[model samples]
Target: MDSFVYSVNATVPIFLVMILGGVIKKLNIIDDNFVNKANKYVFIVALPAMLFKDIAQSNVKKDFDISFVLFCMIVTTICFVAIWLLSELFMKDDTMKGSFIQGSFRSSAAILGLAFVQNMYSNTGMAPLMIVAAVPLYNIYSVIVLTFKAKKRNEDGSLIEVSNAENIKKACINIIKNPIIIAIFFGLWFSVLNIKFPVIIDKTITSVASTATPIALIVIGAGFEGRKAIKKIKPTIIGSVIKLILQAGIFLPIAIWMGFRNQELVSILIMLASPSTVSCYIMAKSMNNDEVLASSIIVLTTLFSSVTLTVWIFVLRMGGFI
Candidate 1:
């Protein structure tokens, strides 16, 4: 019951904020223009700032776990590659392939990982290490898949075919120039070098970082198309199941067999099972993928995570795993 309540408390307010965005959009307080600008702001500025702040502040050396980090990276790689390959083989709609693959595998590790672990352990535990390992790969894989699978349209809305070489070039450039990726690089640099910012600069970055999630969630809500989401509901549900259950179902037992328990196991669970991050929608919209599908997956996953996460936690506790 306590875990259920905690899960609800942690997740419900996020969707509530999204709902508020939808309500405000209906009320004419914010429009498509607002949504577009908010998405860009969160993508280029706020989200990167948040990533930088989180990664930079962590004592990477103090909490270093090479084996655990390698496990996270390997699991993340397997999930991303397997999902992308499966989506390519089975999904016919190129427009949705990127969104489905991304929405299916990417967890909100950076945002929810620490919170969930801290809730259980009264400290950050291995969550930060998980973020350090998994979050960068999350963004990198997203950029790669979204770039390669992005649709190119002519002025008449006809599809344009580019060469594989072109896509390779574009993916490389996008990965190099992605704001979030760049932020992660600098954050790692700062953490490794033990760099400290002045109080004023730190506060300014903190302020900007704080706006990332809320504004991103609002943009998702305001931009959501209900009819469009309903049309994409099948993929949305599938994506949610993959995010909130399937990945964890497969990887978690392996983690247990490898001797991860308590905080380490809990952090792994968040990496494998947390809701698809709201940034999936932002990146999808910005990259010209199916934003509608991306948003629907996020909405469904977030709504269902309250129950799914609670169940996972309960099972873990019952088994004396955490």
Candidate 2:
């Protein structure tokens, strides 16, 4: 019951916010122009600010776990690479390759992961360590896959490749210039240096950061088309199964056998089983990948994670693993 409530508290509000956006759109309270501009703002400014605050506030060095971090990094990289390869071989739709790979492997580590662990243990525990290990790769690999798979519709109504050698160079430049990535580096720098922001400046940053997720979610909801989701049903199911079940199914036993327990184990579970990150949609849409598929994944995963997460928590608790 506690697990269920925790999952509800963490996930329901997100769903409600999205539903609210959808309702407003249905009422014609906001236009397509507003949604497009909001996505851009969230991607370029608000999301970066939020990530900067998250990383900068975390005490990465103090709670660092080398073995744990290495394991997470290795597994995350394997997931990313394997998913990309599978998508390339099986999914003929090049536009979906990036979104599929991202949705399959990227967990909501920064937001949902922290919330779950903190709710379960009354503290963040190893959540920060998990973020330190996984979040950077999430952003970096997203940039790579999105870049390599990006396509543009030609004047002839056929898709053209955008990832030739020159475009690869451009992708590198874009990755370097990516606002989220830059904010992450800055946050890490400040965290490592133990730099403190002035109270007013910190509050201002917080103000900007707070807009990121809500705005992104709202834009996603506003643009969401149920008919388009039916077209994406197969990939959506594959992505959700990989995200909500398979990845965790493959990794959790290994973590237990490796002797992680209690809070550490719970943190790993969140890293594996939480909903796909909101940032995946932001990055996908910005990089000209399949925003529809990305949004579908986010919606499906978020809607289902409450029940799935509760079950995982109950099992872990029953086994005395957390």
Candidate 3:
């Protein structure tokens, strides 16, 4: 009973905030322009600030577990490679192959993951470490699949083919330039060096950090397009199942066998099961992949994950895993 209540308390408010954002959008209180700008703010400023603050303030050197980090990296690599290979062999729609694979494997690790951990634990806990381990690979894998599978078109309606070598180079640049990864880098640096900011600067960072999760959730809600999503329902449901259920179902048991519990288990759960990040849609559209399908997967996964995540948390709690 306690576990169920805790699970509800932890997840319901987050989704409620998203629902509020949707309602606000319906009322035209927040427009696409607002959602776009707020998304940018969350991505480049608020989210980074939050991560920096959490990691920089934590006793990272003491808590750092190389084995745990390796497990995260290995699992991420396996899932990405496996999904992409399967998609290549099986998916009939070439345009959808990239979006399906990307949407299936890439999670909302930084945004929804951190929010859940913080809500339950009152701190970021193991999430920063998980982010450092898995997020770079997520972005790199996304770039590779999206680039190689992308169907580029000229303004005059001609196809443009990109070389594998060019795709590899672009993936490298994107991984290096990713803002969240950069923030994690600096956060680790600050923690290792025991760096301290001035009081005013620290407080300002705290304020900005505080806005990251809520605003990001709101932006996700406001940006959602239900009508666009319905067109891609078949692929959307498949991708969502892979994201919010199958990944966790397959890996959580393995993680248990490997002896992860509590904060570590929760972090792993979030990594494997959270909704497809909003960035998936942005990346698909930018790379000229199937943005419609990407949007559909995001919408479906985000909507379903509310209930699915709660169930996972309840089970985990009942089993004393978290």
Candidate 4:
């Protein structure tokens, strides 16, 4: 009961923040063009700043777990492959493949995973660093899917040519040049080198990085595309189940296998069950892979995660797992 209340309190503000995003959109305070501009700000500018600063500032000596990180990687990869194969086997057509498969594997750490952790622990910021790893992992997977794969028809499973290799190569190049990637690069570089950035430079980066969460939430809110989501709720729910259930199914057993402590298990479960990344949808849209379906999955999963997430939280709490 208490956890539910806490979850609700944490979730409600994000909804409000999203609404505030819409309000900002309407008021013209953020500029109508800001919608296009925002992708650059969060991905290119603010997010990188945050990543570098967080990784740079974090104490390198705190309860590190290479085993856990490796576990997450293997489990996530397994889930990704299982879903890609399963979703392909069960559902056909480019639209459906792109819609369902991406949602199955792509986890929204910034909004859902990071939010849950921050709610559980105020200002500790360790979770954000774990997210540095998640970024490259998420991108590499998404791009590979975008790059080489051709979608098959639902009726006959025939490959339909959509994108060219030149475009695909360009897309890969662009993804590699991502500001967040750059930030993560420098952040890790500093961490490995054990060098402290000057205080003023660190402060500047921190201030810019702080904009990421709010601006991201706002853009997320504005980009909800709920009417489209309503049209596709059934399929969207199916995608959400893949993300929430399938990932949890894989991760939970593995966590238990590793003799994970309760909080550790709960933390991984929450991350596994997070909504599909808006960034995935954005990439799919840019890559011309069922953008509407991707958007529907994003909005619906984000909505469903609010409820399913609360249920998971309670389950973990009751079982003394969280």
The candidate scoring highest on lDDT is 1
Q: State model 2's lDDT.
A: 0.86
Report how far off residue 293 is in candidate 4 (Å).
Answer: 3.3
lDDT of 2 by residue, 1-322 (tens): 9789878888888988888889999999999889888888998999889878877887877878898998888889989999998998899887789999998899999877777777877888788788878888888888888888776778898987553786778778888888877888888888888898999999999999998878888888887888988999999999999999899899999999999998788888878889998888888887888888998999999999999989888888898887
**Model 2 segments more than 4 A misplaced:** 162-164
Candidate 2 lands at a TM-score of: 0.96
lDDT of 1 by residue, 1-322 (tens): 9899999998999999999999999999999998998999999999999989988888887889888999999999999999988888888787899999999999998888878888888988888789889988998899989988898999999999988899889988988989998998899889888999999999999999999999999998898899989988888988899999999999999999999999999999999999999999999999999999999999999999999999999888989998
Q: Write the per-residue lDDT of candidate 4 for residues 1-322, one digit (tens) a residue.
A: 6666766675666557767876877777776467657856676687678667766665534535677667666766777778778766776554667556777688876545555676676643445445655656766677667654534345576655555776478657866876656776777767766788688976777788888767776776666566766776777777888787767865676677778755466557656887777666556654546656776676666666767777877766776666
**Candidate 3: stretches off by over 4 Å:** 9-39, 118-124, 285-289, 317-320
RMSD of each: 0.9, 1.5, 2.9, 4.6
Q: How does model 1 score by TM-score?
A: 0.98
Models 1 onward score TM values of: 0.98, 0.96, 0.85, 0.81
lDDT per residue as tens, model 3, 1-322: 5445655565566667767888999999999888767866776787778778877887678778998999999999999998888777877888899999999999888766766788788888898788878877887888878878888789998888878898788767876776766887898899888899999999999999889878876776776677876877888898899999998999999999999998899999999998888677666766678877886787678767777888898888879888
Backbone clashes in model 3, listed as residue pairs: none
Clashing pairs in 1: none
Task: Tell me, by TM-score, which candidate is best.
Answer: 1
